[model samples]
Target: MTTGSVNPRRADTRRNHERILIAAAESLAGSGEVSFNAIAKHAGVGVGTVYRHFPTPEALILAVYRREVRHLVEVVPALLAEHPPEQAFRVWTTDHLAHYMMTKRGLATALRSASATGGDLPANAYEAMVGAVATLLKANVEAGTVRAELEPETVLRGLGGLLYLDSADEWRKQAAALADLLWRGMCTHRD
Candidate 1:
């Protein structure tokens, strides 16, 4: 009875944590704000639960940021497994990285508003993104889809234009165009 009870509690806690993060992410993405009351209401949990999960707005924002970065890196393998390397790169750029850049702008603003008292975000974001890019590039190179000597950093830089995407406009189409251009630049033989 004790074991079963503890399991349910833990599962509930995990669900609550995810819900809180999702609500917080939506708030940050929309208004660049973090109000515990609003997040709790949006998450359908008590305000105390929001505080229990993240004691401060900074903690919540940082958690959202980390989650975004982790997803950007973690999705690479599944993408490669599901599609050819070239298609995987396009899907990641247009789907994952582009979305991250949009949310990143909001997150950046929220972080700045939170100020130094929140401390700085970890410095591993760029390195982790670069590693993800490198993995994609390696797969493409092995398949002879991309030039062998191309640098992942270079490819990432080319994709950096995604940071300024106009969310209100046709951003998906724009992202696809940008990815197409980058694809042309990286390809050994154009399709």
Candidate 2:
């Protein structure tokens, strides 16, 4: 679509918008900051287009966070295909943790602002992440690989807590340890 087009087709416009969001997320996640000009360059769109799509940095960052969650949701089926249920669960958890770290770096300030204003972050992102985890956990449980007592949401929250620990180095180590603990807790012993 040309820059001056009055109204692009919905699908095409959506594609462009998605591209811009993806580019913005990648740039922000990598650099821990985003510039509109840099995002436009990464998106292969004009700075005006970026402005048209996201009026403020907070809006762009929020969109990027949601996009990251959407991308993570899409990976669930692929991860299931590539790994066993248990392994897939671990892999996806790692991905979720990485996304959390990226989100914390790129959008934490904006998120805090939204909280202060009593604005909710997109709910679908949490639903998608939790749903993916639940699916994987259910699969493992059905396969007799994990304990039925394990709740997917609980495990996810635990992972978040582990990652948010006070010490960065300790947080990483503790996250891994916490994951292992969850795995062991969920595994059924073969007597």
Candidate 3:
């Protein structure tokens, strides 16, 4: 029972937990709803497993929301390392940020509907998002791709349009256009 030792059962439990969260997030994004049965089936786990991991729809939704926000914050460093600063900023905005914004709207509605559990999602998402944007902005500034004075808060405000994107519509195109518009403003000089 040592904490440092890798227990196979614990590892399997972690895997199942991640799988359930991914499945639940996808379900909420695609359908704006949560079905434990469907999530269990999609995650390839028994329904009882899902129930054990998340006793209520509200708990599952909150966990999914937290996982997504964590991903958004965590992915920035990898994106910066993988691409040039400008490309990293663009890709993070158009890919991770956009998808998360769209999914977030769905999660909100689902949370409201799942009133029985009464679990409140955390309020620090704004600060987390601002931190992510700040990291991206700093990289771009260091690379001389954007103005050094550009504020992360302002840039994030500009991206607020993403939250309104209707997944049923041309959201990807709209997201790209919005990001492009913001990028132009953020750039120190046109390429």
Candidate 4:
């Protein structure tokens, strides 16, 4: 599909591009490895098409990661619409943690490279995540369901810590427990 100034490609090309992305995500998630040949095979497209579209492995990985991030970001608004703010916030936090854990292996190299270069992740991605958290948090606070002093960034950092811990299952459970604690701490209780 055309995006802004970019003209839409032929239907076949668009399909090929989408196939490549899907294959890339699967490959990356399953093996944490991405090969042009494999992606092309998975996409049922020729290697030439893969190269034409991505040119480099990093580019392909970036595309897959961005696509996943966009999906997660989009879910925020939908969650907010479908549930109470407190519940929505809790569910999104858990989902975000799961997403990060599932993709951590596949994204390690790219994340490291970005860190080494002192570069930020994609701008839209960063903003989208922050906006989602802020929106949820603000709604809860306004409703007297959460603390006014709660900082979205700090909460995110805590979630990250849980994901980064070495004991995966244990840490994930703790993260859930910690989330419960956070909710309790943030909520207003009137005697």
Instruction: Tell me how many clashing residue pairs each candidate has.
Output: 0, 0, 0, 0
Candidate 3 C-alpha lDDT tens digits along 68-173: 9999999999999999998998889889988988788879887776654667666898899999999999998889889999889999999988998888899889
- Worst ten-residue run, lDDT, model 2? 162-171
Candidate 4 residue 143 Cα shift, in angstroms, is: 3.1
lDDT of 1 by residue, 1-191 (tens): 36545577899999999999888887877677889999999999999999999998888888889888999999999999999999999999999998888878889877775657755686898899999999999999999999999988888899999988977889999999999998898899877
What's the lDDT for candidate 4?
A: 0.73
Off by over 4 Å in 2: 1-12, 114-120, 161-178
RMSD of 2: 5.3
Count clashing residue pairs in model 3: 0
Instruction: Rate residue 136 of model 3 by lDDT.
Output: 95
Select the stronger candidate by TM-score from 1 and 3: 1
> Clash pairs of candidate 4?
none
* Candidate 2 per-residue C-alpha lDDT over 1-191 given as tens digits, one digit per residue, 9 for 90 to 100: 56875565776678779888878877765565778999898888889989998887777777777767776778888888899988887776665565566556656766676456655678677788788778888888888898888877887776675435433345555656667777786788743
lDDT scores for all predictions? 0.89, 0.73, 0.90, 0.73
> Per-candidate RMSD vs. true structure?
2.1, 5.3, 2.2, 4.8
The true-versus-predicted C-alpha distance at residue 20 of model 4, in Å, is: 2.7
Model 3 alpha-carbon miss at residue 119, Å: 1.9
Off by over 4 Å in 1: 1-6
True-structure lDDT of candidate 1: 0.89
lDDT of 2 at 6: 54
Query: Each prediction's TM-score against the native?
Result: 0.91, 0.73, 0.90, 0.72
